[model samples]
Target: MNNSKVFGSTLIIAGTTIGAGMLALPLASAGIGFTTSLIIMITLWALMAYTALLMIEVHQHADNSATLHTLAKQFLGKKGKWLASFAMMFLFYALCAAYIAGGGAQFAERIANFTGVEISGTNATLLFTLLVAGIVIIGTATVDKVNRVLFTIKVLMMAVVLTFLAPNVTESYLMSMPIEQGLVIAAIPVIFTSFGFHGSIPAIVNYLDGHTPSLRKAIVIGSAIPLIIYVFWQLVTLGVVNQATLIENQGLSALISTLATTVHQSNLGQTIGIFADLALLTSFLGVSLGLFEFLGDTMKQRGVSSSRLAVGLVTFLPPMGFALFYPQGFITALGYAAIALVVLAIFLPIMMVRKARAQSQLSHYQVAGGNLALAVTSGVGVLIVGAQLLITAGFLPALG
Candidate 1:
């Protein structure tokens, strides 16, 4: 029974981490070579784990019923509540957009490969948007079960890919020099997005029933798994492919496709292509289901009959519309969305940590470093993220 619970929680953590951003990490790392990117990966991982712990700890101050709203209100007052709410909404929608767009791309590429009849990226976007929405509307209790199966498939396939890809990677890729704007504000959004550390706040807190210590432990352990995966993935990609190919293809999937074709044959390449499509499809579905569940819970807390369809639309529309109207805009929006999540994950949580301390005595797990240093670190993270949003939005240039 204990093992089952642990496995379930681990799957939740892994599924959350492997969302839309996994599709983008290869693209983000391509511009800056692998070695420098790996350092940033570890730094962001630490920051994410810290903030996640803080967020979960804050929930302990109140009951499990306390939402991000209550937590923000208690910690940072009205302004903080408003900002955190808006950022959370924006972050989820923006993330959904990335999932919608990437899933469509994956679906289109697979169909074209299999049937030799191309579905344009645009049509695939609409088709998947509607299909995933339908799945959410049906209210399947088995979604969690489906996720376990899908997560298994995803991990096995990734392991296979890494096994073949890792041995071919060399030291040259790991020591690549840092370019200008290597860790600048512009890069902040993508880095945060790739981490997928946002939705974990409520997820972990609720799972632990607002027990501060357990929540903290879960967040730390939960986040560590993804951080390791991201680092391993970056290393594998850098080692296996040349810098030029990674840059030109713009993502790891492209590299995977090329590598499969070169190492095996077109048939083997097509199999991996299908596997990639399946992985993205299931990842998006898992996220949509989780968000929909959150919305349902929110409504239930208010004594309202939650319409699954409405919740599904809430999950689907912002992203689907973005996918349909502004397919090309998804990547740019993703960077901004990542920065937005950093606000939701880091800033609000840090504020909550202070509030929790002020409200009561600190638990053993909640006591981290000195309060002053934590404050400074959280503040710097927020500023860096905000600056990245500005840069991504074209208000500032990448450092030269």
Candidate 2:
């Protein structure tokens, strides 16, 4: 049991899960209210943790160096691999678009404040993506070292912002009831995506050399860190800001301004601005690294010989195009990511494990509860996708 390896893996999971999604949580959950949001987050954490363990179970039967692309190809055949590929593209692209839309606007605003230069949204997205894309193309080590620094700053600012905001919370606000039952359904997509670190599970397994004990400890502790931070963040954000204000401040910039007014701490806005800017960059780097790896792997598997810049283009372009057209898609993009994640994170693992059980030699490690538990997990995935469809069709109301 190498403690350092497990600890590093834990931070990867925590860092990946705790980024831009934090920016959207208070607004998305506002319609459903704090208590309901808290319950949903806990339930989803259990589901995500369980699925991550299922991935470990699958890893037991496969080579640890196997990425998701290799595993899907070996276990489920071409159609299955293609499905995994599609879902990964959808999820990663949506997330990149989200970070760009959210972060680019922040960048543009900050620039205008400091230098009186107003960058347009598309230019901002392009510039912001260019800045981070190089670090990603340089590869994982650079991204990891940079993300560690950003993640640490985010944690410290998160603590300070929570401290300032905590004293102003009204108990009644914390207990506010859902404005509409349907909004609870809508909030599921965003909240579900918030727990996404399944993208980095293979990386974790490889880091620990497929040591089951270390993998289990890393996944549990890594994921739990984000859940704890989210609890405190939700406590402060939802408790201090009323439902009407949450509704009014639909955009992140507006929300920060609202907090400044509501909390009356002059520095509160500055703290939140720094925290959010760091959050967006760290999350972008994390998700982009995942995309970079996934895309690079796919290209190699297909014998597509390409340079790092080529891979970077494929990884960053579609999202930049999306952000270009619909510049304020932060929340909407997350919803889309959640839908694709239902397939990538939840359904794919269920299929792999079931197939592994059938064809491979029985491994010592298996997720508790047999086929019934797998079925239940798949069922929950269905519900999340369905909820998103309802929102898309205007059958359910989602907060901005």
Candidate 3:
């Protein structure tokens, strides 16, 4: 394998994994405390890594050009294709809505802070949506180049946050237990969503020219980058901001505003806002590109015109409408996304691997652990879905 491709693919996986999700992480895991959250993070990282290899395992037996749609159709038939379609649509739209809600508010906040001229939340959302839509319509390479710059800025901002908070950040908060145990269960879905670079597996495999060992190395190291960064994030944010503050302010906007003043560095909050904007923008570019392509494919299948501009319009409509009415759409949409991801990311990969293995006539690359591994991973996915359902229905305690 060319070493350069491996490095590029590694960045792709890492960039895709680290996104606006970090803005939501502290709030989600705040009540559960850092230690438990760390355990959960590591365990889920392994599970996500395992499923990604399972994805590659399926690819080895299938066509190199196959997408999730083709893979599902080939392995699990038409019904499975339909199911994957619905789940992908749901998960992508939810994420688009989320970035709009969170990223737009931050944009508006930044504008008002600097210029003293307030932008309406809806207008801000519209502007950001159009920005992403335009870039995605241009092409993938544009998005890739743009994301690299934003990711670089995001890293710098994160470094600044750590520096500002370092003097006061304590490890004690990492040791703090949940005020109520149920928060641990409640935190699972959000945390699960954080490790979501699985969607990039097929693309990365293709990018690295189907070299399995290189692909495996890319997956492990790429996923691990976000894990280490998240650990630092949890340490700084949780160390200073107690559980009560996270509970009191459910709105991301409100919570971030509090952080600005809480940390006593006058510019720290603004720095964090810039960090979040880049995160949201990078994530939006990725998710929008995926949805745009998926929707374009659907339109072509149904004999509709799949022009770039026309498809882009249809892509943003649903999620934009949701953001208009649901100002709190960021957290709400992410919660809904967690459930859809359980189907799209976890269960589908497991089912495809099972079917592919059973039908293979010759030896090929396998991900190890056989049937037992799939069963265990699927079980965890099920638990995450159940936990999310409980949180949605108000049966479980939710910190934010």
Candidate 4:
């Protein structure tokens, strides 16, 4: 395999994994304590990596051009296709809504800082939605280039924030109050959302032309980059800002504002805001592109036109409507997206892989640990689903 292919694919996976979800980490994990949150982050990273490999395993058995929807239909019948389609649509839509809500708020803040004029959240969200949707309508090749540029800027900005905040981290803040068991359980969905990269698995497989070793290497390395970043981020944020402050205020905006005050650096707020806006924009572009392509393909499969206008309308309208109605729901939207992710990325992959094995299908790349691995993956899925259910049923409090 060529070195460029491996490196490019790795970037794709990394770009897809690190996005709006990272912005919520400090706030979402704050209640759980930094140390415990780190452990959860590591566990979810490993679990997500396993599921991503399983996705690749299933993809290998299908045609190279096949998507998750197509694979589900082939292996799991119409019911499976419906499940995959709904999960993908729901997950991507939630993410798009979150990006709009978060990104628009940041844009408004930045503008207000400069002009001394406040932009309403609804107006900001509409503007950002139109801008991002326009970019998505241009198609993937253009979005791919823009994603690379944005991803590079995002990493650099993250490093800058980490560097500035490193000295301000207090030991007292790092080891803040212990969390209730229920709160920790409630954080599972947010943590799972942070490690999401399964959307890029099929893209990587096609990018590498099904080169298993290269694809495996790309997935492992790409996923690990975000894991390391999350650990350092949690340490910095939790070590600088108090738990009570995070829980009381909630969301990335509050975190950034608090960090600025805590560090006594007013400019830090603007820096972090810019960093966050870029993060959301990059993630939104990647996810929106994936959704657009998927919808376009499905439309074509059904003998629809799948024109740029039609694809763009289907892709951006629902998310825009959701964002318009619920402008301050970045973290809440992420939790919902995580639930859909569990269904499509976790449960569906396990079911498909088992069916593949039962049919005596073989792949050059199989997730090791056999039935035990499958069982463990299923258990992880159940844990996530149960956590969400408990939150919905009022047995556990929801994360902000």
For all predictions, the C-alpha RMSD in Å is 3.4, 1.8, 1.7, 1.9
Provide the TM-score for each candidate, comma-separated. 0.86, 0.95, 0.95, 0.94
Q: What's the lDDT for all of these models? A: 0.69, 0.88, 0.85, 0.85
lDDT of 3: 0.85
Point out the higher-scoring one by lDDT: 1 or 4: 4
Give lDDT tens digits, candidate 1, residues 1-400.
2445555665567667765566566666666777667777788788777777676667767767777777788778899877876787677677677767667777777778668988888888888788777776776666666666776777777777777667777788666654556434455568667776556566556665566655555666777888888788777766666666666675435655766754543355665565566666776776677567767776787898757777776778778888777665545667767667767777777777876787786553565776875877677676767777577566755321
**Model 1 error, position 26 (Å):** 1.7
For model 3 the local lDDT of residue 156 reads: 94
Clashes of each: 2, 0, 0, 0
Candidate 3, superposed: residue stretches over 4 Å from native = 138-142
* lDDT per residue (tens digit) for residues 285-396 in model 4: 8788878887888799899865788899898888888877877778878888888999988999999988887886453567898999999889989898888888879998
Clashing residue pairs in candidate 2 are none
Candidate 2 per-residue lDDT over residues 25-102, each given as its tens digit? 998898878999999999999999999999999898878998887889989998988998899889989999999989
lDDT of 2 at 332: 87
Q: Candidate 4, residue 204: CA error in Å?
A: 1.4
Give the CA lDDT, 0 to 100, for residue 139 in model 2.
83
Backbone steric clashes in candidate 3, count: 0
Candidate 3 lDDT at 102 equals 85
Which is better, 1 or 2, measured by TM-score?
2
